[model samples]
Each structure stands twice: as C-alpha cells, then as structure tokens.
Target: MTKPIYIHGSGCVSVQPTFEAGYFFDHVTSYTQNPVPALDPDYKAFIPALQLRRMNKSMRMAIFASRMAMQQAGITTVDAIITGSGLGCLRDSERFVEALRTDEGSLLNPTPFIQSTHNMAAAALALSLGCKGYNMTYVNNANSFESALLDAMIYLTEHPAATILLGGVDELGERTTQFWDLANYLKRDDATIPTPLIEQATPGEIATEGATFFVASQEPGDHTFGKIRAVETRLEVDAPEIFISGFLQRNGIEAETLDAVVLGYNGDSRYDEIYRTLGSSLFANLPQIAFKHVVGEYDTVVAAALFLALGIFQRQHVPQRLLLNHSSIPPILRRILIYTQRRGQNHSVILVEK
Candidate 1:
C-alpha cells in the first residue's frame, strides 16, 4: 500500500509575482507574448553575492524557492533533496555551445560548461542546504515533476520519518526561444494574455519558465497544507476518459467527490481538447480550473499546479480568475485532482486532499 505523504509548505518563482509578498494568482503578472521570463526576485536573501555571481537563473530560482519552502515548513534541513527540470540551465548550455561552436572548442570559459548539466540544480540545492543524503534529479520531458514526486513518495513511505525537499525548475534562454519560435512552438505575437481556453486559439503555447518547491513528509504536522494521495504519469496519452477513470478508481476517489479539478489548459487548440474531453464529461459540474494561462507553460509547469492546489488547501480560497467554468465556490474544498499533459504526451494525474 502507498503511504500517505503530506505537503507542509511550498514556494514558487514564476512569471507572476510568486516569490513576492502576496498570493501569486491574486496580483498576477500579465504578459502579451510567448516565451515570457520569470519576474526577478531578490535572491540576495537566500544566496550570497559571491556564490550568486556564478549561479545561473535556474539555480537561483531553485535555491530561493527551496529556502522559502523550508522556512514555511518550520524545518531547518531536509533528509534529502530532489529536483526535476526538462531543459536545465538553458542559458548556460546555450552559452557553452555558442563558445564551442564559435571558437571550435578552443579556450572556452569553464563557467557555462560547468553549470550546463541537468543535475547541477539539485547539486546546487544540496550544497546550499548542506544536505548530503540521497540527492537526485529527474529529467523526463514534461513528466519531470511527477517523476520526482513519485520518488519522494517511495522514499518517505520506506523511511517514514524523513523529510524531502522536492522541486521543479526551468529557465528561458535567447537561443532556446529562438529555436522554438522558428519551430512555431510559441504562440504568435498577436496572441494575448489570459489565453482563450476552449475557444479558438492558434497552435502553440506560451513559452514561460519558473520553479515550484515543496516540503513533503510522511506524517502530517501543524503546518500541513494538503496530503498527496496519489501521483501517476504516462509517456503517451491513449484513452482520455479511461485513463482518468482508472486513476481515480485506483486511488479510491470518485469523480463526483472531487471539490475541484485543476486542468492544464495552455490555450493550444491542437491539444487543449485533451482536457476539454474530460472537463465536459467527468467534471462538467465540478469547479474546473485552468492555470497555464496564469503561470504560463513549461515542461514542469504541472509543479505550479501542485503549488496552486497547496495554496487552495492553505487558504481554502480559489480566486475567481482560475475558474474556467464559473460557479459559486464550494462551501469547503476537501479534495482536488490535478491533471496535465505536455503537447498531448507525458500525461500526469495527481490527487490531493485537504
């Protein structure tokens, strides 16, 4: 049997002012174009100038978010650290490749080369927190966050008393965006903010980046925000309704009992229908919410959805903006289901109970 895992605290750094003083969805940071970059936060508090100088944007976001989550959970340290990222440190990777291409691998600066790997983010977090046990990173396309989440669950179920600092982060890069733009993977310039979900939208998604960190543990405490009941990921999405039904049945949660279902509707007409199929049938009357329009979509953007669920469990409030289909808020939000897919692949479903 799967052991119960609860989230004590969470932190997010995203296109919105997530790392700021207020709830991110409340004072949203709007955008008009694709490939939006995360708002810069004051990193000096979590990182010293000397170390910050060498760290890339992705690393900074990870460290700051991890610190914020730890503080909120009222814990000084974690037994382990795990992170997930699709394109880890693209800025550094881009620079390193450019230098190698330009100079034919002659006298290239080692800074970018040293920081370009995918595991570097987890490495930086462990080094910063002085944690030396069971550190790992997962890079599984858009399933990255869910991959890390499942691993954390397995570890905690076995350890029973260990705490894990888990997170997902991705950064924007000039060259990377340019490549995406050429491939038409980004929404056109005319595409506006608050993406028109279920409405006519041109092909492509908003290329944005951010990080979400959580302090997950085996036992619930005073700081508990929500309990993660189950997490599942699929490399390919075959049957929409069947997949969701099976997932819910496995977790002993019925569709009618979910207070809310968070869907990743990123405004791509080609793929948004994947969510619509489920929203229209299984969750028609439920308080259906979509978030990519708020935070924008990245490989690990589902991590932001997890963060959103934690916020709702923490405050018992779901801001009106996130509601896709309007309805009076539930008297009490007890169960939430978060479902997301990356371009119709890497499908993930997570169950959270408050």
Candidate 2:
C-alpha cells in the first residue's frame, strides 16, 4: 500500500470573504442575477508591481495562492506543481476573442493570447518558485481538480520528493456569465430567494470562481491539515450509493464513522437531486454541509469544499451557515468525506482523516 499523503498547508481566496480566520459566511450575499466575484486579496505583499502589471486574473490568483501555501508550509521548493481549471483564463480569452472580432484578422496584442492557455497558471507558479521539477495542468471540466489531486497522490507514491504544490483555480468572465444567463444556466429573476445550497431552487445555477492551493507530502508536517486516505472517481456507475458504500468499506470506514459529509449542492434544481439523495439517505445522521450557495457553482468548486473541510478540522467547529442539519456533536473531528458530481457525471469520493 502507498503511504498516505498529508496536507501540510492550504490557502484560499473565495467569494464568501475568506481572507481572515473567522466564519466566512457571517452574512452570506445572495445573487439574483449577476455572478459573484471573488474576494480580492492584497497582491502587493506577495507579488511586485512590475510583474503584477502584466499578470492575468488566473495567473495572479494562482501565484498568490501558491505563495500563501508555501509560506504556511515554510518551504521554498517543491517536487511538483499542478493545477486544474475549468475555463483557464477567461479574462485573457475574452480579450483575444474581442480582438479577433474587432480587428478582423489584424495583428492583436499577444499578452492576452499568451496568458490564455490552461497550463499558464502552473507554469507561472513554477517560474515564481524557481523550482521546475514537474508541472502539469488538468482541464477535465468539473473533474479537473480531482484529476490534479490524483496525479499528486501518484507522484507522492512514486517520487522521493519531500513536497508538492497542487491547486485549482477558475475565474468568471462577463461574456461567459451572459451566455449562461441566456441559456438559463444562471438565475432568471426573483424566482426564489437565495438560501443554503441544499434548499430548493431554480433552473439556473450560481456562477462564481476562486482559487485554493495546498502543500502535500508523505510525512506529516507540524501543522498538517489532514491526510488523504483515498480518492475514487466513477464515470458511469449504475448505483452511486453502492459505489460510495464500497469505497468506505474498502477504506475500513462505516457510514456512521464520518464526522461530516461535504456535499456539492449547487442551487440548480436540475442536478442538486444527486447530492440530496446522498445527504438525505446515506449520510443523514452525520453533519451535512454545503458551500456552493456562498461561493456559487463552478467546475473546480470541489476545491473550495476541500478547503472548507480543512478549516473545520483545524477549528474543530462546524460553521453554522454551512450546516444542512442543526444537529450538533462532540468537537472532536477525525474524518470527513467529500462527494461531488456534475449532471450525474464525473462522480467523485474523497476520504480525509486527521
């Protein structure tokens, strides 16, 4: 068996005001029409002005989050750097598209075009760290982050390196948001007020984006967040419940043993049922939690869910805002499970223990 990979440090910049150490959703904001923007961080501290002037949104976010994770880990170099992103750099992509349309085949600025690639973030992090051992990026839509995570796990098992930096990042674009609204991927009007993600909602889903980065190693650090015991992905399973049960069983854990189950319940009435089935049936007695409503829905949203679980483990307290059940338990957290899917595809199960 492969040695367990431990999460030594984590950093997040999300939509629910998560820069500091308090409960992020003290006063959750609702979006009736517009997409939520990520909470901005002071980039000057980590990035210089000359470099920041040319960095795109994705690059900036990726570098900032990577630096934060490294600082927390108190390390300067890592064995590898990997990232997953749904839309790449939407800001730069949009610029390239607009230039193509307006210029009508004329030469346009290459800055946007250069930064638009999906692997640009990972490359930028490598350049910033000055350590270029191994770098990769995954663009597998909603499963992108999980794909990167699995790669990191494999690297930890095969390589003798001491550390690795892995992350997920996605940014909302104006044109993309507008397109989603037209296709009814976003909320239409005052159809229903925003509530917890698990609540009944409308045809549209909340569109938002952010970044989360973590440092992982085979040996546990002094301030380790948790250990990733196992990760399993199912493309098309006849019975998701059975698949999940088998996963827990293979990992020597029962349904009742999980301290909490982090679910990806976006407000989309169409797909939230998948999560509801698991939350209401299999993990009913455990403390059920969801974060999509606060940060909105995106392909790499599960990264945020992972960060939330880490926060819960560190504080040993469940935030009242994210709770799907009012039931309380002892303040001792030992294990957590995260389940997520998109349109009943790319179903994933992750087990983490402290």
Q: What are the C-alpha RMSDs, in order, of all predicted structures? A: 1.1, 2.0
Backbone clashes, each candidate: 0, 0
Output the number of the lDDT-best candidate: 1
- Model 1 spans > 4 angstroms off: none
Tens digit of per-residue lDDT, candidate 1, span 112-217: 9999999898999999988999998899999999999999899998889899998999999999888988987788865656777787666889888999999999
RMSD of 2: 2.0
* TM-scores, one per candidate: 0.97, 0.94
The candidate 1 region of ten consecutive residues with least summed lDDT is: 21-30
Off by over 4 Å in 2: 21-33, 191-199
Provide the lowest-lDDT 10-residue window in model 2. 190-199
For candidate 1, the TM-score is 0.97
Candidate 2 — what's its lDDT?
A: 0.82
Q: How accurate locally is residue 153 in candidate 2, as Cα lDDT from 0 to 100?
A: 87
Distance (Å) between predicted and true CA of 43, model 2? 0.7
